[model samples]
Target: MKKTVLPTMLSFYAPDLREQIEALPEGTALIGISASGQAIAVDLDAEAPHVLVCTSSGGGSTTVLRSLTAQFLHQGAHALVLDPKRISHLWAKGLPTATHRGNVAGIHDALVGLGEELARRLDLADSELDAAPRLIVSVDSALAALRQLTRYWETFRSKDDPHTSPAVAALEAALWTGRAARVHVILDGTPAPGVLGAAPHELFGTVILARVTASTWQRLAPFTGPAPKPSRHSSRGHVIQQGESHETQAIWMTDADVVTWLTDPDDPQS
Candidate 1:
C-alpha cells in the first residue's frame, strides 16, 4: 500500500511558546500547530500521559521538547529533564520548575525521585485526596540514557543481585503508576524495539516522528502501513495518537524566546 506523503512544508500559523501557553486550556498542553492552523494539544489529566518522540539529528525534536516543557511549566507542572547528552537540554537548567539531570547517575536518581513521588501519590489516593500536581519527566536522547543506565547498573549493583536494574525498575514503575498520579514522561530519540522492554507502546499515548527513515517509521508506526517517502526539505512531521495520524508543523522557538518565556512576566511577541 502506498503511504501518504506529507507536504515538504505545512503552512500554518505556528504560535510561540508564550502564545501557545496563553491559549492552552487547563490540563491540556499545546504540542504544535496542526495543518489546519488549530492548536494540537494533549490532556495531561486524561488519556495516556506518556509521549514518545522520534527524530533524526537536526529534525527539530529539541524544539518540540522545549515547547512542551514550557507549556508544562506554564500550567504549574514540575518538569524533570534527563539529558544524558549534557548539551541538548542546557536551556532547561535553572528554571524553578525544572530538575535537570545530565548524567546517568543523575537520571537514575531522578527516576528514583519520580518513583517516590508516585508512591506518595498512591498513598494520597488511598486517603481519597486530590491528585498531586502534574509531573513531566522529559528525557532527551532516551535511548542513550537507557544504555548508559545499564552500564551504571553493572558498575554499582551487586553482580549476583536478582532484580531489575534500578534505573529500568524506576522508569517502568513511573510508566506504570504515573498516569494515575498525573505524572507524564516524554522520551525523545530514535525508536528501538525492546529498548524499554516489551510493549513499550503501553507507556505512550502519542508518538511524533520527525525526519526519520522508512525503517525507523516501520519500527515506530507499523500500523500506519508503509513509511512515507523521505522529504529533505520538510520541517513538518507526523503525529500518531489513538490510531489517528496527522501532519503538523512542530512549533519552533528561538533561544531568546525560550529565555523570555522562562524569565519575563509579560506575554512575548510571536
Candidate 2:
C-alpha cells in the first residue's frame, strides 16, 4: 500500500459541517489547520471556488466585519463572507478542501508521515524539525499515534536532494499544487489581512485589510491619491489637504486588489 498523509480533524465545531462533511470522500472535505492562535481553512478540492479571504477585529462578535472579493484559487466563481468571525460557516457549507496527505497504513503511519510531509512542504529546514513540529494532524484518537510517527521523519529526505529538508520541500510544493490544499485562511487576530510574513512574494498577494481607522487611512493617503499640491498654510511652507469629510477619512481598498489577484500567478501586475 502507498503511504499517505491523512487529514487529522481537530476540535472543530458546527454539527452541520460534520454531517455534510463526513459524507465526502476523505480527499473531498474541508480541513482546518490551527496553530499559534491562528486558524487557516482551505478547500483541498476547491478548484472551482473563489479564494475569499476574511479578517477580523476585536469585537468578540463573529459577525461580518468586512467583506472583499479577490481572484481566488479556483477559476470560476466569487467568494463572499458575512463575517470573518463565523468561519465555521464555511464548514457548515461543506466546502470541500484540506491539507491532508491522505490515508496511510492506519493511525501510526498516518501521523508520522504527515509531520514529515508538512516539513517537506512548508520550506522548513531540517534543523527546524528537531523538536518542534509545525504541522499537525487534528484527527481524534490519532493525535498520539501521529506524535509517535513523526519521530521517524527526522530521517526522511527527498529523492533528488538528500539534504533537502522536509519543510523546505513542503514549502515548495505548497506554493503550487500538492498532496493537500488549503482554501480560505481564517484570521482570528488582527494583523495584515493577507500577510504571509517575510515569506516569498509568491506566498501571497492582494491582501485586504478588513478595517482601518481614519488616522490609519491618512497614513496611506500618499499612496491613495493625487499628490498634495503646494498650499499657502504659511509663507515658505507648503501643505497638502487630504480632502475633508468624515466618510473620506474612512478606509477602503481599490478594485486593483480585486483585479490583481493571486490566482493569476503569471500576472506581472500581481
TM-score per candidate: 0.85, 0.24
Which stretches of candidate 1 lie above 4 Å from their native place? 1-20, 126-131, 160-163, 190-195, 233-235, 267-270
Candidate 1 collision pairs: none
Model 2 lDDT tens row, 103-185: 22233343335445544644645465333322212221122223333443445535664443342233233334332323222
Q: Of the candidates shown, which would achieve the greatest TM-score relative to the real structure?
A: 1
lDDT of each: 0.71, 0.27
Error of 1 at 197 (Å): 3.5
> For model 2, what is the error of residue 85's alpha carbon versus the real structure, in angstroms, after optimal superposition?
6.1
Residue 143 of model 2 has an lDDT of: 24
Off-target runs (Cα >4 Å) in candidate 2 are 1-87, 90-189, 192-203, 214-222, 225-270
Residue 41, model 1: Cα distance from true site in angstroms: 1.9
Please give the RMSD to the true structure for each candidate, in Å.
3.7, 19.8
The TM-score measured for candidate 1 stands at 0.85
Q: After superposition, how far is residue 132 of candidate 1 from its true place, in Å?
A: 2.6
